[model samples]
Target: MPNCNAHDPYTQVASISIADYDYPLPESRIAQAPCAPRDAAKLLVDGPSRPIDAHFSHLNDYLPPASPLVVNDSKVIHARLAMQRSSGGRFELFLLEPIEPASYEAMFAARGPVRWHCLMGRAQRWRDDTALTLGSHPDETLRARRIPPHTGGEGIVELSWATGETFAELLDRLGQIPIPPYLGRCATADDNQWYQTVYARHEGSVAAPTAGLHLTAPLLRTLEDAGHPILHTTLHVGAGTFLPVKGDSIGAHPMHSERTVITRRLLQGLLAASAPVVAVGTTSMRTLESLYWLGAQLIDSQGPAALHLPQWTPYQTDRTPPTAESLQALLKRMDTLRVDTLEASTSLIIAPGYTFHVANALITNFHQPRSTLLLLVAALIGARWRALYDHALRGDYRFLSYGDGMILFNRNCKKA
Candidate 1:
């Protein structure tokens, strides 16, 4: 929660316009590649008084002696696929997620034809009957049919391959890693490993939870040796995460909902934490925040409203649970439902004046100007994001995914 509650979070009347968040970033400043040793990237640690710059390998120096590090373990799949039209016009299909089966496991295992949400680059020239072949094999052919846009100009494509291999195997054989367009280059062989975290297990997200990229196995072992418990949850990052904020006022912008799942065990660890909970990435932070609201709505459930999180849900009303109560409510609901897993979607936007329900500290990659991600960083430390960004730029730190990482803490709060 915010230190002060006199002002409503909806309007955030004192907040600056979108233009204020914009800063001059040369294309050269954006990191085109990952650091050779992932842990060798730079780290910017900001405390209540001052900010210090260090290397990610020395992450323990900046954090509390011991704490809970909540990580997003959603694996980045080979979402980018290449399809050729009969006319030899090449189109790109970036698979968003499975729409037909909806279950990640089932979709990966489904053999015949399957429909999925996908974003296309050269969508204009494609037609329903256009057949696309993959990997120079007759068995890997697919059709490019279109579906209604999901949101924010994303188009869906229905694809099917003849082989018995799972979709996951097909992608591994024919798809490229979906590197951000801001990188201004095509995905390369190096990205196959560097773009993903060492601990990535479940295959889903189109993009990586970049912050986790810094934690090498050795470093993780070191942290564990020192008694910090590392817990994980999944939030399959959608392509929309890379989209920039277009509206002048963030209040007018609609947030993109992402699929998230937190098991009862993970929730138990979160609620039972005796130390500060540090969210490893913005997605993880959003998951924790959404969990609190999920519990809140569960507390006073009138119906299915418990599942939906509006863009302005955090700021719409002043009423909120005191962190502890929210977790208890979630536990109670989960017990009543006799379920160990909480599967839901979240569209929560963390703008300035938004009080954080969980995550006392954040470890994240440097974001772009006027992006929802930047707004999230701002919400954590208010206007200090500009100063931090400047510090990062002046220190010659690389920016964006596959770039360097930074850590920042909010005002002191009790453990959740």
Candidate 2:
């Protein structure tokens, strides 16, 4: 509970309170559903010059050939599981991340009893041995047993089912799509399709990487034709993605931990690419930036076989490798270990005054007020984020996960 995000000796900039990044958002402006013809949504392009208001269909026009687009291919799982207690009281369990295997792919493919860190809806009703049951399929019914709380309101939940279906498949059959709570409505059938990005492959995220939703198949094909190969890395966004900052200062907020996996191929592409890397969404941006710090840790430790990134690692660590060198060392370590993939979790809180090393630009959706996503924007463009948000609001761009998108230059990042 102390100041976890203390200022690093490497950073000379002063830290700002959470209040500095808060903005106004009208409820009516939040997009309840995605725009039809995904790429037809509005896109705001902010550069070193004036901001350009344009539609997403013209996204190809803004491409900087030097920076290839890196996207989060982490798929959104049907994380909301509803069940009734023995007393017939309805409650919901939203799976945040797996506590067992702790790997997104393994967790999804895992077929047996599974344990997960979850947020309970109507927690008080099911605090005792109530035996929550869910009728997932005619042939199979699922049951949940609550474990003791880890911390705060969330607790561990153990689940078992009779069907041979993997946990991911079972969730698909019975769980509801977890949507942005600000929508004030339940997920509809259409959301099962529209909420997912076209490139979604790996399943783990409780929420979709909304910015990726704007790039259609044709748009990607065009980007490829234009010589930018879209690369992927996975970061299973946790339920905390939507949680509001409770602390008065950004440093006091308990940053949510999310799992990220980067491949040897992905790292090589990132280093060798002639174009500056552009992260497709804040999730991707976080993954990309976290890699730098992760590699920095690797460099400092002489490349450990297993690596972990603490929530306040970035703020407190003075050991940082250059973007290219950090990535190169990571690649070498992975190759030496003969492992094709590097798996880790990040609780990184990207904020104003933070230095960026990977992405030169960010393509992200309009975020909630007082959210970490806004802080990432502040880190990228400084006070200009206020003007861009103002323009998006006044221009009637739909906001939130199912909303329009924006592109901001990494104009404020310090030279590596």
Please report the candidate that would top lDDT against the real structure: 2
lDDT of each: 0.81, 0.84
Which candidate leads in TM-score? Answer: 2
Per-model TM against the reference: 0.93, 0.94
Clashing pairs in 1: none
Across 1-416, the per-residue lDDT of candidate 1 in tens digits comes to: 33244455555722447887899898888998888788999998986677787898999877786788999999999998887876788877888878888888788887767788877776766665666656676765655566654454366667777778888888888889988888888888988998899988888899899999899999988888887889989999988898776777665666778888868877888878877789999999999999888878776663273466766766766568688788777777678789887678889888777778778899999999998899889888887898989988888999999889899888744444
Q: Please report, as a residue range, the 10-residue window in candidate 2 with the lowest summed lDDT.
A: 6-15
Evaluated at residue 47, the lDDT of candidate 2 is 61
Q: Mind giving the per-residue lDDT tens digits that candidate 2 earns over 1-416?
A: 22334454223222466787788888999998888899999999996578898888888788787568999998888989888876788988888879887767788898899899888888876765667889945468888988875455588989988899999889999899998788899998999999899999999888999999999999999888888878999998887888887777665577778888889878988878776788999999999898888888877877555676776667666566678888887787888888999888888878876778888889999999888889888888889999999998989999999899998887655444
